[model samples]
Target: MTTLQNEPAACAHAELAQLRIRVIALENLVISLLADTSERQLAIARDMATYISPRPGFTPHRPTVHAAAQIIHLVGRARHFRPMAPSRRSR
Candidate 1:
């Protein structure tokens, strides 16, 4: 009886672990895609972060604002992975 009771919990734990792995993989894929984008596109994405920013004041919804901030943070992190352009003086 104890084993049967624990089975569902174990299965749920396994499923949660798999979901975490998938989320990490998706995040890595997005970072790679962002890294490959042109500078112009990256700049546009940075601009989008600003657009998503919540205006200062009391608000009923907080999760939406937090998610937007997270997105902005992710964009900033992905930008760090972008390759630096070679200087023209190197030619």
Candidate 2:
């Protein structure tokens, strides 16, 4: 072919090559972003799971002395009350 024809063809080929390279780079960038998003989601899921999991031990609702006194008082009150008649126990 003549130089004029060859020049245009070469320019078109170069442009097509550059476009292919850009498209490949864009695809790689998109894939990388998706992977990053997936990693972030997994980390969030793990954090939420940890947050929702039950703890190992119990917690007191009141101070130690007050709670102990309340328990003793209730037990003493229970002992003072009697439900059965004397005859039932004698039988």
Candidate 3:
């Protein structure tokens, strides 16, 4: 009886875990694509993150706010993959 009651909860937990894995995979793909894109496109993506960010003192849904922050953080990570600029001394 207790096992039957816990079964649904276990299923739900498993589904949630799968969803999290998918989200992480998607984030990594986006980071890779962004890293390969032009600087102008990357800047546009950064602007989009800023655009979606919640304003001060405004109550936005938690997930929405989190997504915005994730986008910005992903962009930062993508930036790290970009090639380093040539030093002035090398020019």
Candidate 4:
């Protein structure tokens, strides 16, 4: 007679256990998803860094001081040869 009266309480306990199992499964799924997202974000960051970074073996072109001076001299010579306009007449 007591077992028959406790039968409804036992069913309620079983339902509660099932709900707990489902919640644990959902938590596991969320953790896995977060880990995957973190990995993908790291990969994308590395790819973007590769695109923006200069190559290891690249050597930039730098003009020597002598070459720069030569260019300046040439420009000066051209300026010296340019025709000068007549001086402005005073009013």
Candidate 5:
């Protein structure tokens, strides 16, 4: 009876120890994967700076067909047709 009791405890201890080792190994693997990802991000950022142009004027709108449509909409919204003057009030 004593041997049987000790057998179960030993089995539980061994199983717990194995689980701990596996958890530690998995933690190390995740850390290594994160480090690799960081290195990759740095490489991609360098590539972007090397390839992308940086000489456009400081305009809020992108130089696209969408910007043209937006400009037309703005002009249509203005009540007066003056380029740099406001309309006089008819009191």
Candidate 6:
């Protein structure tokens, strides 16, 4: 394949790795949130909405809500356990 053709694959691999890291982070956040998933989701939704549809006042410049949802979904599907949350906790 030509260099031009190979460029897409390299870019995809880099993108995938970046996405994986993001997914892992999201999963950990979710697990920490635990049964409070709704609160966690609402927070993410608010942040994302502010980013995508900035208000008349000061607003965030983050990605859209859809993007956040996608990341959450990927995390749920890809990993069984969160990386940061200690597997064994002390009393």
Which predicted model would earn the best lDDT? 3
lDDT per residue (tens digit) for residues 1-91 in model 6? 9999999999999999999999889766755554344546745644654455545775545554456555555445434443344666554
Please state the error at residue 75 of candidate 5 in Å. Answer: 51
List, residue by residue over 20-84, the lDDT tens digit for candidate 2: 99977865554444344444554554454445444457454345435454434433343334344
Error of 1 at 61 (Å): 3.4
Q: Compare candidates 2 and 6 on TM-score and give the better one.
A: 2
Candidate 3 local lDDT, residue 14: 100
Candidate 4 Cα lDDT to native: 0.54
Provide the lDDT at 85 for model 6.
44
Computed on alpha carbons, the lDDT of every model, listed in order, comes to: 0.77, 0.54, 0.86, 0.54, 0.51, 0.60
Query: What TM-score would you give candidate 6 relative to the actual structure?
Result: 0.37
Candidate 2 versus the native: TM-score? 0.40
Model 6 residue 59 CA deviation (Å) reads 44
Candidate 3 Cα lDDT to native: 0.86
The pairs that clash in candidate 2 are: none
TM accuracy, model 1: 0.70
Tens digits of per-residue lDDT for model 5, 26-46: 655544443444445545534
Compare the candidates by TM-score and give the number of the best one. 3
TM-score of each: 0.70, 0.40, 0.77, 0.38, 0.40, 0.37
* Model 4 alpha-carbon miss at residue 65, Å: 68
**Candidate 6 residue-wise lDDT at 71:** 51
- lDDT head-to-head 1 vs 3, winner: 3
Clashes of each: 0, 0, 0, 0, 0, 0
**Which candidate, 5 or 6, has the higher TM-score?**
5
For model 6, give the 10-residue run with minimal summed lDDT: 75-84
Show where candidate 5 strays beyond 4 Å.
38-91
Alpha carbon lDDT at 88, candidate 5: 48
